[model samples]
Target: MRRSLQWVMYVAIKSIVVSCLLLFISGLVQAQQQDQSVTTFKELTIKSDWLGYPTPETVKSHPGARTVITNKELTESGARTVEDALRNVPGVRVFDESGTGILPNIGIRGLSPLRSEQALILVDGIPVTLAPYGQTGLSLFPLTMNAIESIDVARGGVAVHYGPNNVGGVINFVTKRIPAKKTMTIRETLSLSPSTERMLADSYIRVGGFVNDKLGLQLQGNFINGDSIRAHSDTQVTNIMADVNWYPANNIDIKGSLQYYKTKNNLPGALTPESYKQDRHQSTRPLDRFTGDTLRGSLIYNQYFDNGAEFSWTNFAHRSNRQFFFGDALNADDTSTLERSSPREFLVYGSEPRLSFYINKGIKQKISIGARYMREEVDYIVDARDLLTNEFSVARDWRFGNHAFAAYISDTFFLFDDKLKITPGVRREQVYLDFRNNQTGSKESNPTKDWLPGVDIGYQITDAIFLFGNFHESLRPVQFTQITFGGAQAAERADNFEVGLRLTPLQNIGVNLAAFRIDFDNKLEFVSQDVGFRNLGKSRHQGIETEFTWQPKQIDGLDLRTGYTYIDTEQRSGQFKGNELPLAAHHQLNFWANYSRADWNWNLNGLYQSKSFSDGANTLIENEEGSIGRIPSFWVWNAQITRNFRWDKRKIKAGLAINNMFNHNYFFRGVDFSRGRMPAPGRTLLFTAQLDF
Candidate 1:
């Protein structure tokens, strides 16, 4: 009763603040309305500033494979984590180690998913990696499920605008939009895992609205506290975010965002084959744990001119700290007397400005030009501790820095009455690296540059069908370790090609098919700790992807969507030549079905992946240590049901979800030092409730 009263009081205070803000902003709106000289153009809308496509209809003209998951689809699928939601996209792979998505291992196409090194992750077009230029690894993902509004995945044709490590592509998360009227939401979720006898809880609160026609503000907070399905695995996560949108003038718009995220979690270290078979849900390495936090902010400004031209400038900065502690042992069961801890800190700052306009010289054309500059710094340290005496000593200390600059230009030509479209673009990149071994007082510096070029072609054969193709060159800057401690001196490069078509056979049915190939050179692979990192020669990755969706008119409130991917990868050089890459499954499939009637909703989902290798050698038999082996094929199913209730101008939603309905067991071979059989989660259930006003 006391907690309830506190909530009531909080809500009342929030209402008072909202009312005052609205009244103050309404007066400004009226004054702005009196000045009719200011012009408002649709092209300068807030959506146009996003890095991803402005609207769903614009996707049809994309030069390469593109996938967008809407908020409705995510909510209806009962997606408790980002890894679960990414399974619906074709040619994408997800591996969960923490079970909470705090540390994501995502792969696009056939690239390695180790820390998602090859992929570029973004939130509202702002980089989220620990050090976007020096480290490319995502040690901490600072995002909450409730704060997301949509997801956009670009598989190819992005190098002209994005850079550094976009070899795999870009993944952008779009946050929830500010509402037109005052709104508030409170949500709670409870999850139970019978196998491990653990329960998890998640709480979320959001308040947002446009105070008036000229300004908008939003605030969101999410917290999670619970244990994973494994013993000794306890975790806590906190996230807070704020956003502001101000249109001081009719043709000028400004947006700002700030976020803080922190997490503390225990790592259920890998288990030996014997231990895994005996009890996969037990955690033997109780000393292993991880802690991380991030503080980020961004600002965007846009200006529109009467000549149908727009100028946009975006600036962002972030600081992050991550630390991991684990036992130092050759195998999971080894009796090691020493423990190791790695602490890393990063600071990043970036600015980008772009201009887009139209030109007509007997043929309609669109032109875009952009420039970017970014700086990143990292402090990496390694320390060792004696478990018996509790004594600590520093082993290695290093600092890395990077200065990067890029400029790009693209032009789209419309011919044959706008039926045929061709776009050609090029980007120039220059990077300067600085590294210092603090322990030895040694320093190294180097400079690298690259030229990336691409072309996209699209033909509208008919109103119902669109055909598109693209060929682009991309580059991955040399990693910090590669330049300072490894034998690699040149940057990695790849040529990407894709051909795809989108069509609608019926009013309610849509289909998309694409074929892609990537030829990569100077691929970097991590050797042992003593050997550091090295270039593993060339490799080839090619694949086919198809997606289908149907919303039949005959059946009210019924929807179906499915996607499939087939990838073929091979090593072209080195000792592993003629062998298939690790974790590159040959086939993957996903299916979803949903139906709604009145206030009731039902959803079902299915996912499957074929067998793959755990090591570059493609070992078929599991070793005694369980560090290398072939992963078996597995399939899982999920179902959910939801009901909505409304009364007295209040709305409420409740839902229940069952995951891994068949209780299927699956495991992945360790990628880092935790070398052994890492078992995945088992059957689980989730109950959720939400209140809106």
Candidate 2:
């Protein structure tokens, strides 16, 4: 009987395999019949696609938007991260944060990217920000540029199709989907920047391939180490990610991913000018630091019905535990005081479940709807002594659970062979915080709700030219960090408008110009606790941007991506005016130009963000500036040249990177010390070599 059952199971498995093989082969044949033509356009010289949210409804009569950079772009541009790669996307502003040590903060129009999750970040449709908060900084989630297949920056209502967070638009880090052929990568970076203690080394290895037409996978891992360019600071980071995709039928596909990450740093407790001079680097001071581990997994399935109906489901979960060591240098050897640190380790974890559906085709109209449910819990305790010896105090111990729910609906209408398209969308979200973890509360936690709507319009003058505009509203509910005495503001909102023109004058060149305004209500500002519980509000912002790409006919192997942004941010209702937004620049200029021929490649890239206020308050109180607390202007230059070689089936490449090519000095302000200023990293150098088979 067991043998018979095994035989039956084997037969069923084989039959399923045979069916999938048939479907895959059929898709291949069909794909071939479609005359798979290879175009030289790597998104750089291509016109706008309806998939992006770049326009406003009434202005454009319809909505069309999307910007892309191909794998060839990554290779040719020689960018190292999402920020480094997307310098030319319309309305994007990248700014340096004093000591984050990851990458610059990214913003759209006038919205501060670091302040809220309103500006969403996605990796192949998966979120990168575990939580949006000051402590939950962007640096927490690290992504190597090498893993990117393309990057799509959608502004205005384009964010609506992505669900409710579409308020500030969306930055989708579309990962590289392995091609029909195999691919491999190896990268390494070195630094000689001045540090408090140690040097820096950042390296990564990624391999991707398809076992067949229907199955593919990508495995990647990396390590990062850098010393404080200022003082008393050192950083070490490492992470690994794995992704797999499978197609079982012509219309159905499944993808899954797993990630593990860890980071350790010599955290500077806080630097006052006196301490700053005493120790140029924070790592030279105390050893109070933070170390943490995070593990995450996600599974997604996509199905396309013959009738043009579509459905998708994404399940994701993240588990992380982190500990903060309070300053205890006063009496370390003493066992009694050794455990008397001011802060203790806490634990938290959460999960997100999402489902979406859509219908498009002959329908003249397309509709989409989706939902997400998030729940998280945190545990905290006080340490007077050992758990066995320490007496637990109800007043000091804390624990809690929080839940957030969201749902959204969006649709698009097409006219004139889709030459004119309009997309309208809306989303409703509710959040509940349960002090369920703490037994000491007369009231555990409060609940909140927010509603956000967005719109996009696009007009295709011709197949290769389109003009668009967008209106997107963003909402960010108060996160756990704002739960100081439960008096935190309910939620914040921003209404941003963007109008732009995108044209592919020729098959080999593209240009985009845009003007935007982001008016925000109750936007978070930096203020002293002595002033008020909340930051200053009533801010208005406006900006203009232009992006360009060119691949000259002479150098068919050359690709150039560049752009500029001029931002005007003001606290129209507060004390600050004429000052640029905090943590964002008023003028950002960046570019990438690469020339490749034969076995040699030359790439030059430069990034610049004009000085702006480092403090959200835009004031210098008890500050060195005496009035305006600002981050002075800065620029960084990088150049790379590579030589390619091949032996049999093996391909090899060697390159060099000159970071901050010139040993320039600059201060990174926004401080809590006698002097509120930090220095930028000095000139650094690196080399790398990669082999592929």
lDDT for model 1 comes to 0.81
Provide TM-scores for the models: 0.92, 0.78
lDDT (Cα, tens digit) per residue for candidate 1, span 494-591: 99999999999888899999999999998776666787667776899999999999998999999999999999999998789989988899999999
Worst 10 residues of 1 by lDDT: 35-44
Task: Tell me, by lDDT, which candidate is best.
Answer: 1
Model 2 reaches what TM-score against the true structure? 0.78
- Cα RMSD of all models vs. native, in order, equals 7.2, 8.5
Error of 2 at 48 (Å): 18
> How badly does each model clash, as a count of residue pairs?
0, 31
Clashing pairs in 1: none
Off by over 4 Å in 1: 1-55, 328-337, 486-488, 527-532
